[model samples]
Target: MSRPVMGACDACKRRKVKCDNANPCANCSISQISCEHRIAPRKRGRPPKGSLRQLSQEETCESIENATADMIDDSPVNSLFEQDAASDPQATSVLEALATPFSPGTLTTPPSVSTVLRETLGKGSLAAFAAVSRNQFVPNVAHIFQKLAAAVNHQLADEGETIATCAHKCVDIFMQYLFPNTPIAHEPTLRSAAALFDLVGDFLSPEDDETPSIERLRALTLITALCALVNSAMSQGLFSTSKSLTWLFYNASRATLRLYEEYDLEFPHSTSYHIRMWQSAALQNSTGRDRASWHIHGESILLAVRARLYDEDTISRLPQLEAQLLRVNFWLMYLADKTAAAFEARPSMIPNDYLAEKLTLREQGGQDSLQLDLSRPCNGHSLERRLLTGFHLKRRLWAAAADMICELRLFPTRNQVFLANTEVDRPDISGLVERYLNFVGHVDHLPEWLQSPQRALEGVEAHVAEYQAASFWAQRSNIMSVYHCMKLVILQKCIEMAVPEVVGLNQDPIFWAMQKLETSRDFIREVQMVPFVCFKVQGEPAVSVQPFSLTSSVAYSC
Candidate 1:
């Protein structure tokens, strides 16, 4: 057989099939493939048991020194490690301990540093270098690390309560104080979800393979963010606790939200918009108005758009509960966008044409298709529904204000152009005046509840508890603040634009100032009527900056 084949053909061995003792096996011959009988020799038996042995102390020292010396000679920056070793004799011991080699038979551990000193130096260097380098560079970032540590400790402290208990408390606090203002979450749904999250501890762990469903994660994110907001609210006054707890919850919420978004990006959900809105609100509460919060708000709007929230048909097709929430979120974002546009001078992300289209569609769709579903009879007895009604009324005012802002932006007044220093022809002031008048007319048309805080509270059900009544008052205060602030801003702008001869008597400086002063007085009076506890629970006033602006106007007029 061509000098009998020593073993199976390579093809037959590789295939792990039977092979005839021939140069070309029958299987390879039939397949017309190469059948070389080449194979590497295998080890005959197990390795000798006593081949490995521990090195003597002297031998170990010599080996370590030789290795260290070799590393030093081979490294371009050998001088650095030598200098480090010389400056701190202790480094030599640490290196020896860290670099100690283990016998093959012993339970081996990885070296603290890499095998090659060159690679270690290329990286951050050994622990020895860290000591000297830290003193030089640590001061620059020490405060940041200190703050992070404090936040971590605060989070860990937690008053000896578990996360579930804290989450439940946060939910209660949020529902009582913040929900009426935002009302983004459904009470029953949020409570049920919180209860579920309380039971599912494993889902909260990062290392767990059992991933939480999108809805569960969304609830968790919202709850975490709410916790941050509640802590921030609680820590408001001079006597209140430090903001470390707030920072802790805020960071946790952000981390949870990042994970939630990664999942959401693949399988989008409508409630993702709601969670994002809560996060944006929490960011604003904890960090104040910043690009981060604004960007979060923008993302919320994008989520809304993706959900077709602006499309009446799509909204109508959704379940009643989902449609209600989508509507609420849309209006809340619109109010925020308009508020930012008016105060912060940021452009509204929702295009005017889209808003106009939505309005037209709603009007054409009639009462059944109203954006807020105001035509649908709401139970007057339900505090949640009542709060939502108040929000709807507030939404109307904000929509009008937004329209006014858009109009003002389009046609710049003399003062606006002068301030901007743009070389443009003087635009007519009539459009501005008309827009201002239109906004005023819209405010006047608002129901009695919005026009007066007392009337607003009158709508509260008689059977409601004292705390529930307080929530209603708080909600009323928030909406009324927006109302008064919008009027103040418009009147202030008018005052700036007014010319004694060209402007009418109503648009005159004296008339505008009197109106502004009266509005400020009413705002202050309304704020005073709100209980001190309300302020404590609500954290910073909803229109905190507006009050100062009003105060300044009053002082200037005086």
Candidate 2:
């Protein structure tokens, strides 16, 4: 008969010695390594036992034989347990769990100086500064910088887009958080990079020797974010007007350009920046014509953009143009509004009789102007009631330009693409054209207290084609998907009205409310995640909470 088998510790199994069945045998326990044990769940029922006295030798032998037979039957269970332990919860360790797996197409390595860098540059790396030797940690800083620099160089040498993107992101984050505010005791890059390494130190410990995919995605996202920010500043003039803010904008721009150069990426179009700089400069002082120059530049940009939209190779130009045009309309409206206000505040500031007559008309009836439906794209009426001052006309033209942009965006396709091809069929923009007519029909009826009639009328007229177009933009998903972009645009436009003295003092109620609209727009962005893109000048946020039901999506067409 076979003797009954029993479990043993790893050390006992290796030595072929009988184990006392401690969690770990004495040898392994003393070595201070992991202690593993195989334990089966307790059975439900009691085992059979002798009822009275001790058994005789012959009975004991028979019992032993039965026990040996039972052990043989359970041997397969032990083998199963061994298989499960290889990856089982009981077998897997905390250290192993902490190590995140490296992404594919990357190399992970054991923690070295890079580990120190991650800790140092990471978010909260200075916790144990008193315990660890400062000198030891300091040396690791240089080593980390060397590694990062080498990594960047290697990425540059390689043609992989992913690697290049990742390298740029690492560099950008380092620049944003580290170099900007931190006081540097050494060369900027060294301290900055070291600071960065400190943040990610936890991951470096017992490093799994694999390259991370998270880093790649992180880099791509950061680059995209930076681009979006720069675009916002350019389109909205957020950082352009103030001297302090301009530095922020300029640094962001420089950082982006450096990233682009690092990967041999082509520069973005040159026109957008020039226009933004021009708008910024105009804001330095109160000059309407100078502000209008921004509008002219915008028109030039729009025309240039038309020429470049067709070649499949020129896809980048589309967004650049769209953003610039959006900005142009915003600033043009800004200048017109300001010009009208100037005429109101100092009637003597009227440059000519044309402006003077319009200002008179605006002063008499413009303060009570009602908003036409901006949700459905349409143009407003012509300014028949105007007189001398250019203020009303300027304000109207600005509003009209804004409406035109909305129509331009909603047009089935760009006119420039059609111009590029001699044989290309020109589809009618009649839909938007019709909406513009509806907008005009209502212009004569809308109150002038809130806006200049001419401006209101022109804006309504620009939406004519939107009424006839398909309702693609009216969907919940589509509206929300681009809501962030819309909010961004609105905030940018409102910011354009930053003339310190003139805009506030304008007697025209519409111009007066423009200040309120500035604050209102910002507040609306903060609260209303679901934006209706209203064209009506003064609706409360509560009015916008309902589902947007305009047939034409060009409601804010201007």
lDDT of 1 at 525: 91
Angstrom error of the Cα, residue 362, model 2: value is 36
Q: How do the residues 1-558 of candidate 2 rate in per-residue lDDT, one tens digit apiece?
A: 323234554433322233455655554565575444432333334446555765433233233333332333233322332343465442223113211111111122213334434544463535532323212211122222233333333333434423234334433332222111111111222223233333443423321212222222123223322322222223223112122222222222222222222112122232233323323322212121233333433343343334442123333334543333333333333333333332232111213343433221112221222212223233122211211122233234334333533453444345566678868776464554453444333324323412232333433433442321111111111222223233233223323432113112334556546656655564455334322322111111112331121101111111
Q: In model 1, where is the ten-residue run with the lowest total lDDT? A: 549-558
- Top TM-score hit: 1
lDDT of 1: 0.52
Runs of candidate 2 with Cα error greater than 4 angstroms are: 1-246, 258-307, 310-558
Alpha-carbon deviation at 363 in model 1, angstroms: 10
User: lDDT at 468 for candidate 1?
Assistant: 63
How many clashing residue pairs are found in candidate 1? 0
Cα lDDT, model 1, residue 302: 68
Q: How would you encode candidate 1's per-residue C-alpha lDDT over 446-497 as one tens digit per residue?
A: 4444354344456554543454666666666666676677666665554454
Model 2 poorest ten-residue lDDT run: 549-558
